[model samples]
Target: MKLMTKLSMTTLVASCGLASAAVADVKVGLIFSLSGPGAVLGEEMRNGVELAYEQLGGKLGGVDAELIYEDDQRKPDIGKQAAEKLVRSEKVDFVIGPSFSNVMMAVHRPVVRAKTILISPNPAPAPLAGEDCNPYYFAVPYQNDQPAEAAGTYMNDHGIKKVYLLAPNYQAGRDVMEGFKRTYKGEVLGEVYTSLEQTDFSAELTAMKAASPEAVFAFYPGGLGIQFVKQYDQSGAKLSTPLYTVYTLFNGAANEAVGDAGLGVYASTPWTYNLDNPANTQFVAAYQEKYGTLPSAFAAMAYDSLRLIDGSIAAAGSADDLKAVRNAMTSAPFQSVRGDFEFNTNNHPIESMYLGQVEKDENGQYVLSNQATIVEHMPDAYAGECKM
Candidate 1:
């Protein structure tokens, strides 16, 4: 009788273990601007996450993953609705993105409240980095202000004293300008905040031309960037006044749309296609091969987010446990394509920002070539304010 009971107990235990492993499928909600002004950036980010999944063999830490994508349409209300659907209906274990900061701000609270792991591949707004920081939120990219700060510092060091600033009148726009002014030791000829949907920059260009600042700094991403660059080029601004900007302005993805118009522009970014590291080299080549275009900084961040999530799940040993995943993410176990990546107390990436110049590569393609390292292992300014 004892021997028969032991055999039955072992069989039950084996069956239970098999059931657990079989039901270990993870569901992830991916929200980003699939249409509207930010579509290009969103598409690139989507591709990055998709590629990462493929490379992982459709599994994260030995558990199969199902990714549900939602289009936010670059609207805050739409983003909020999408977040609700992902959390309430789908009950996703992890959430990634809403490409722009405005959309992120609209959706962050609900995700945090649900205690779901929310990892942003882009748009690390200032508030989330500071007092509003949440234990459930992690930003795999640099803070919204970091790139702008790098541009400002670069321009200041290069003796560009007077500059004109332009951005969309939004949270990120305001943050970018504030970041620039923080490091810029120059005269601000003027600052213009245009509507997010404003396609034509003729009025802004006229004003910038009139100001005749030594340099012009602008933060227009996706379609807006393409329009701005083409208009600035047509205005003959490239010949006399230089343009110094951040990502989405002078990278391979943007240059494909801006064409020769983006030539001679200087931009600051944490990752570039030309970064000389084995991980980056493999990523750039694989990305180009799969998508038939160069991966942008946006794409790089998305790729990193997936890898980070994968490592966290492995470390935690279970994707369903939010606390374990959060604790594992805080430790940052993955290697980033950017070479050196760590998370600060604010959950923002601590990485180097590089100066890149828009130039033609050997293949005659316009790409941002890495020129120099502008900042090294720079932690976000708001991190100190974060109690987490």
Candidate 2:
């Protein structure tokens, strides 16, 4: 592993040497929830970045890129601490993600104050794209609400009327619920916010059942999603109302844990293993070969984030010049596992979203299926509000 890493770093440095026509070392920092409830999501992201780094031979945009990875433990305070150390001490040229929204919010000020560019692979809480929109921050993935927006549209199209809403008590959870209601135009029987890492969802489920809504909409990611799906199924709710979700029950290790509980469930996303794009197919095959499992949406986003940064550095010819790098990244057009994507004015993606169904394959293994493109080059709510 050490030899592979050294070789990759050398290749990256060599590429950067060629691009700059001079030698330069570029530092990049990654902050993610590598432990706690969100560890699996962070691990997927870390794997994606690692794979990209290895494939690039340690060079991004023809520059020697040095990555410093730190775990946030899915806590806001810890993420802030990591951000401070990475920026003020280690002096990373660019930053990527805190995975969870609360952590991102905590890390944002220090990163922006340091004038370093933040390339968020996840954490699309509404504020960062709205009043807090910063010139240095960019998200390769769609905002947190985009998937929920698609779910709302699906419900609208299906003529569903009343629904109960459930999400964690946090910024991202609220963002998704609001986004869902924005498009559905249906009656929300009730809304419930559970503790951030709490495992028990029975009380919330009981309330949801009491409302007797036509459908149940939720936004639970990582381990919470797995627990919710299992409990929802065990509660016998599946026998009655359908569960409509955004990034809740889908593919990857999460789906594997969900098992038959997630079967027939519907969720919305911008990418899936079943997507018919050439890029997606290649990514899936390569990832499966390397890791012995298909890549998750988080993994795909991380891969794109690295490639995007590489493209930006290549375009600007210097990762050391963060302002130039940021500008290049903002305008860079790059290929992703999800196919073509470009940043909107808010530094968030204007990309496609799909409604996917969870089902078992012939092996009786759970997988994502029926990926239907619901929106393309979709605009976020904050688009009209952003001046840049």
Candidate 3:
């Protein structure tokens, strides 16, 4: 709540015409994995929101904003608790949550059931984009399979036949490989699913090297990704074949952690810090200024999440009607840090996807150089399956 020392009620009401009655505080809850393996991503997601709130002059929906944070610890049950608390007790209008698909699948139903808008910065599971789509849920990032599909397209277009696939034996890990195979017209040299908790990949790396595929595509995010790159480089695999992913480049530290090992690695992404656009230019500058480091795709998408909400609030003139705000968001002019944005009928994003190669910048820092546009204005494949 903001204190108005000398301002009259009329002045307060006039300044923000979003409310018919006196404008009250807007509460937004955040649920992310603030502990365990995903802490870095969760921290960045929160950082993105904080930077967004600061840039927006500390107001949301034309009212003083109240942000409540809940740490999911990268677990589904904990995430469910966070969602219940935010909905049942805090009564927050919206929740920016779900860093991982496991947690997202766990908490999505309950939060949507309660009529609170649940916005996920990452992990737009294909299930939610199709038969299970919910109007109350909004995925700020591209659909989980979108980038993977783009990677598959890149390989197919470039005629990279005989590729090996690897990922953690989890929902998101499986989804990416599935998406890759969905578009890839290539020989599957081999397919490997590793344990989510597996730290060392000596066995898997040996197996991949034996297959001797033209290329390798793997989805081992978080610390696992960092480890995978380092191991792949050490296993003498990088000398023979290249590494590709849709996950590693999204995290800022992954580049630094892998360092020279990451060179020549290609990633498929929807947003990169290098995108040249008015919004992106401003965001990259502001984010670096505020965070004292380069922003990741996780941060970019979260920052865009609030910006879209701000635009929706302005168009709807109030957040009292949740559906109205959602309608305004979808139908309104979609400007994002990624240039243009649109939502499919299922509330998934319809946007351009790109292929980026890890290269050194002028400062000798590792950066994902935009290689080419893999897919433009690409709609998710499951859009047709969505009843909504």
Candidate 4:
């Protein structure tokens, strides 16, 4: 948590009594799991947002911006408290992320209840997309299930008839299974929901191997996915049944730790660091130069989220008007790292999903290779149920 920022505080012109020259200040609250297993993901998000702020010259919408961060500790109640503190106490105009779906669910209430904009950089659960959708809520990332659905569609196109499913026991895990099922018409040989904190996968691996599925699909994230991939590699499951996963290939620590073990594994995501556009190229280079490491999908999405915020505020002429801000956001007035981005009717993203295989780069390090768009302009299934 040391050396958190590289930008200086903004100076206001009002000190000289120049009212016309005074610009509004925007407060952004980041509530992510900065402790426990998900800490790596949280750090990635912070780094991305920080990089965005720095790139924006420490200002948003030509106004001074302040970022307040809080640790949810990977707990529901803790995340809820953080949300309350950000909105009711700190009066943040925008609140972003609790990282995991469970934590996102907990924080959704208070942020929306207080009429603050709840824009998630990641972990857009189904509840927020469907009947429970709120005007104050918006998600920059694709719905939790879109990547899994794209993976399932890819498996079906490849004639993979049977597969085993594994995910952490949580709302997102369930969404992965449901999304995969929605597309893949093949039989599911086995399904396992591992505990969020469980690192060892010996028992689960044993059962999965016994099932002899054509391929294995898993939706583990953060440290949990790192351990699962390592154990799955050690179990030699990839020797026979290939592994298809979401968020494991190009995410921060998970990708680096499971490097070689992840070779030949398949992944689906909305964006990749190696996209062939100038925005992505610039972002990747700047992020690597600043952090001395490749940015993850978490970072990329977070980077886009703040850029969206900046563009929205500018389009609104300032951060003082919520209705104008919301309108500008829905218009999506930003050049995203993804190159192409827009918000759906439900305020979730309508984005293309790509499939990729893990392969060694020219430097002999593992990278997501052979990426291609599998699902174009994919929208969440729950969007229809959203009243707003």
How many pairs of residues collide in each model? Answer: 0, 7, 0, 0
TM-score of each: 0.93, 0.92, 0.92, 0.93
Best-to-worst order by lDDT is 1, 4, 2, 3
Candidate of highest TM-score: 4
Candidate 1 lDDT, 1-388, residue by residue in tens: 2233224323443543432223548877888887767888887887788778778766787787766788888889999998999899988888998899999999899898998889999898999999999999999989999999999899888999999999999989999999999899989999999998889999889988998899999999888889998999999999999888887666546788899899898899998888888889999999999888888888888999998889999999987786888899998988789988899988998899999989988989888889999989998889989996
Which regions in candidate 4 have their CA more than 4 angstroms from the true location? 1-24
Candidate 3 — worst ten consecutive residues by lDDT sum? Answer: 1-10
Give the residue spans of candidate 3 off by over 4 A.
1-24, 248-250, 332-334
Candidate 1, residue 23: Cα displacement in angstroms equals: 5.7
Q: Return the lDDT, model 4, position 3.
A: 19
lDDT on C-alpha atoms for all candidate structures: 0.86, 0.82, 0.81, 0.83
- Per residue, candidate 3 scores C-alpha lDDT tens digits across 1-388 of 0112113223433454433222446777788777788877877787787778777766776666656678888889989988998899988888888778888998998899998888888888889988999888888788888899999999999989899999998888888988898999999999999988887999988888888899999998887888889999998899989899984444576678789988989999998888999999998899889767778888888888877778888788887777888788775344688986788788888899999988888888777878889989998888899887
Residue 267 in model 4: lDDT: 91
- Pairwise lDDT winner, candidates 1 and 2: 1
Q: List the residue pairs that clash in candidate 3.
A: none
The Cα error of candidate 3 at residue 87, in Å, is 0.4
What lDDT would candidate 2 get against the real structure?
A: 0.82
Please give the TM-score that candidate 3 achieves against the real structure.
0.92
